[model samples]
Target: MPARRQAPVTSHIWASGGRHLWPSGEASALQSHERGHLVYAASGVLAVHTERGTSIVPANRIAWTPARFAHHHRAHGDTDMRIVFLAPSLARLVPAHPTVFLATDLAREVLLALTGPRNSDYDQSARSRLSRVLVGELREAQEQPLQLPEPHDDRLQALAQLLYENPGDNTSLAEHGRHIGASARTLSRLFHDELGMTFYEWRTQLRIYHALVLLAEGRDATQTAFACGWANPSHFIAAFTAIIGTTPGRYRTN
Candidate 1:
């Protein structure tokens, strides 16, 4: 198992937060909070893992975990992670479930200010105002398709683990079905019904998740592309950009 990153201490108040430095591959233990919170990676990538699936939080995005959702954090590189707990009043503004939102310039600045060293200088009212602004910015920001939802069906779960264990596996749904005792059409239907996505779409998300971890570990775009099962680097780049809002090469630099 990877070493654990320093977990955010539990806080039930509005705008309570601090920054933590995490080395590559570090992870936090699974836990839930009484209050909803936001996580931002000032640098590197943070993967927020829950039973539902994982949400990728790169520098340009922020991830929200609703109250009582069991989750863990994993650092993909030398990560500067910031956390901010929202009081119920502010939390009510966001979605009831986990989500990833684009970190606009204003939102990023607000987050940094809330978690930065100067946070201690603010009084409760000032902090509350800033927290509201942060939430407002997020309200205006676009929700990202960075989440990989897990499947609940037995065969789908088994198949998910198989592909997860080896993201480079390029086997078609037919081959997977043959190995797992289900027909290709059956598996396709299960994927759509249980996971709300096609097999290929889900596989692309899994591959991109793997690609992110590889790129965070300093792997180049071409190497990460092939390793994650993309035969053509151009396709990999396009897919990565579409989901992550940046090229793999560019993501590596920031």
Candidate 2:
């Protein structure tokens, strides 16, 4: 709603297997709909952002966003995305929060079949059975650590916002604490107590989230490393691989 002016709109399209079969959105677009739906990429990468955190979705990973949750999707490279709406009952079967699942072969096939226009050829019973299988596959899907949880503390929130806006700022915790009216130790405790991670860990997670977006935009990994506050490209690579399970160079589209 409200014209969604700030970010590029996610064009609803799915291009799979070297064939662009339907309409699709462009890169870095943000949009949402009311109904609960599952988003899968047939090619390239997708990043889903919500209040909970951000999830990086490669082609083999499926992303789910529940109904009425205001989420934004960004495409990395020339991505082909598929959106399938779920009935209210079926939607309840999945987690209410945004989730990422490892797409199994069966799950992927059922998904493509369900989203494709040829599904019109299938009867209701056949369609219903397929839906059930898809949901079952989703239920067993392995979750990924693609999220950067949000903090509730006002001071922590301020610090997070600052880093989010300027990922390249390599400010020490003591320096930030002085500005935020807390000691470095105090904030470090909050990060662990509330967000379950150290200050540096959370910041690295946030930076990687940003790095995914930049890499999705076809930005070079070296450039993305510096842009996202990583002073050393090699170090950034190590951290990124540890979290994302792949190198940033491979994450980008040529």
Q: In order, what is each prediction's RMSD in angstroms?
A: 2.8, 4.8
Q: Write the per-residue lDDT of candidate 1 for residues 1-254, one digit (tens) a residue.
A: 13355645333233487787887777788899999999999987889988878898988899999999999998887888899999999999999989999999999999998888788889989889999999999999879858889788899988998988899999989999999999999999998888889999999998988898888788999999999998999999999999988998888886
lDDT of each: 0.87, 0.75
Q: How far off is model 1, as Cα RMSD? A: 2.8
lDDT tens string, model 2, 83-133? 777767788898888888878899999888876767666777777788788
- Candidate 1 clashes: the total is 0
| Local lDDT at 37 for model 2 | 81
What lDDT is reached at residue 161 by model 1?
87
* TM-scores, one per candidate: 0.92, 0.76
